[model samples]
Target: MLLANVPITVINRTYSSEHKLISFADTNTLLEICDKFQRPFLHFWTTEQPTLILGINDRHLPNLAAGLKGLAVNHYDYFLRNSGGLAVISDPKVLNVSLFIPTATHNYSIDQAYQIVADLIQTIFPSLTIAVHEIANSYCPGKFDLSVNGQKIAGIAQRRTQRALVLMLYMSIAGDQDGRSDTVAQFYEQGDAYRQDRWHFPKVDKATMTTLANLVSLDISVEAVEDQITTALAAQENAIDLSSAPELLRSAQFINEQATQLKKIQLRNNQLPIV
Candidate 1:
């Protein structure tokens, strides 16, 4: 594995119980910073708020008014994230993990990157029989969707630039997977009326999604799995803290700058008229 040859120097960040938009922006910034510096990073965060995140390629709902009203009814704030996927639901029980690596540094092909991420996940939960394949009825269906016992639990998405690539995945740790799926399904029912003829959103089946708690015999709390992630990372390569590494000080500075830039971009985006 290419990951085995490289030292796991990560800039760790946690956004537990934080706004989804803020965390999304921060993750976006981290990807840029890591790419700019040609460094590898591991980022983990969790969102407590129920939010519906739309993919950039997703159809912009023609009737956003009804979509916004539907979201308000379900107590889900909505936003579009800069990533490759359709609508996905997130709550406190879901844990989002992202890996930012320089494609040139690692000589990574797109397939290789997906394999590395799937391998890392298998490393985290070694006891379980995890299968990586597409779930046709699942929301955000993809070839890299991780499943166990014929149930989809996590979906992987990637964004590749000239120098950097990000493998972002979300795991259903412990939550009402059915309810979350239903929420997204209904949101589409109301929002599907509006279309940009861009991408086809899935007609999600609530039964297609499952959580880790349901799949594994042992406790699979977000914190427990998070600890497992760090442990697994340490076993694979030396994991360092950003503050402790003086030689990589510039990466930290770049992250700060990216945060500021993202805030301004988000603000400008929000100000744009929805047509």
Candidate 2:
């Protein structure tokens, strides 16, 4: 199951400040209806405002209230993502790419899904020596964290259902990498004041992370990165317009399903006890 042989549907759009959560919900919605298209869907998006995205485990923090208060005090808006991975920064400087693949015909293993995105990233930046491993003291550190010379640049996470899978990558293209790390590290400090959850929360060190702009001489802006990704997948491009595809975004089933997903997100976030 080579990526080049699979059809790709690219949806490039931006989410406003208030509607940022919709971006995630849309991905969930697409994954639910992915079988109807019988192809992979690539969604490229960025948020208008900076947001702190928490993972499922973050909800279980012993001092979750202090964590939420710290975020509010710092003027940060956050939500628990349906996907896995600890808190990650999502702002205009970051470029998020989500690939939703239908598995009705071919089943994809966990490593296969991660490899697909890693391969695409390598293709986009062929000049750099990108390493795939966990970067010590980096936020959201994982086995699939993409790094350059020990400095983490991007992290990948995935959410899988029986019929489909959505692989998400948050690439730090051009921004203050250290400041982003600091923000997350501080959140952990406040969330786990006693450091009781040391093993669960990462001890982020700003030195362990970096942005793509600092690594390559190429134009590493978010827009440029998006263009590079598009070119990398050009062979499998099967562009679709949502306005014309009723079965995808306009059909009754899609509409109801998306609404339901959105409601679930709202309930999850709203039900969290605030200190």
Candidate 3:
């Protein structure tokens, strides 16, 4: 396990449209670092386009064929994530933060992992009235979703290995959050089986979800939000300089080893190949 005072490696990054899979693969790379070297990592990434990332359960959605066709028509590329949670939308306005750390216990509580992120968000936006609870009819419904004034702004998900833990969150920073919500709702509607499927998907209502800009009523750009987050992190903990860290370089090299399987997982889940 990492020493209590070890510096947390912070990576503030954004990716090209084609690097979506590489983005997730990077987190797994950090997970391996935690497992192998007992190091901890923090990552924040922004996507350039509106991408639909579905969860494992999405493969069995009843009208999946229709949904995939609709995704194609809407010009939104899709992929299956290595973590849990239903479908989620990402764009230039959204920020995805993940924490990869070592775990000492065999069974880490899911809520405990989520609370770590929720607490960090509270630290970042101390003035905002943040709430953590499931917002029904919201995309990626979950018990630890973060919201302000009853409208969801972030969703939390977690994945764990025997000795490593990864907690992931997607926060909408700007843009028409309602339109994004509507988009996911439409995907589910197209993919619905007249409620015949054993599993229940969320009934997304745009009003029940919102962006940080909407919540604060400020024209907060995604870049500004990213700056604030990284600044806050730098102030709160020791920041590791990734450029000069040899161990981190090796950790990134590890990602190359896992790339083939990461690419194939989505295809096996019936997702479209990234062109």
RMSD of each: 3.4, 2.6, 3.1
Tens digits of per-residue lDDT, candidate 2, 1-275, equal: 24423556677768886887788888888887675665667788888878888887788777788888887787777777777668899989999998887777778889988988898899888899999999968988899999999999999988887878888999999877887888888888887834673547788999999998898854668888877777767744534333333345667887888899998888887867765
Task: TM-score each candidate.
Answer: 0.85, 0.90, 0.87
The list of candidate 2 runs beyond 4 A from truth reads 1-7, 197-199, 236-251
lDDT of every predicted structure (CA atoms) = 0.72, 0.80, 0.76
Cα error, residue 225 of model 1, in Å, equals 1.0
**TM-score order of candidates, best first?**
2, 3, 1
Candidate 1 structure quality by residue, lDDT tens digits, 124-193: 8788899999988798899999988778989998887787888898999987899888887787777763
Error of 2 at 5 (Å): 7.0
Which pairs of residues collide in model 3? none
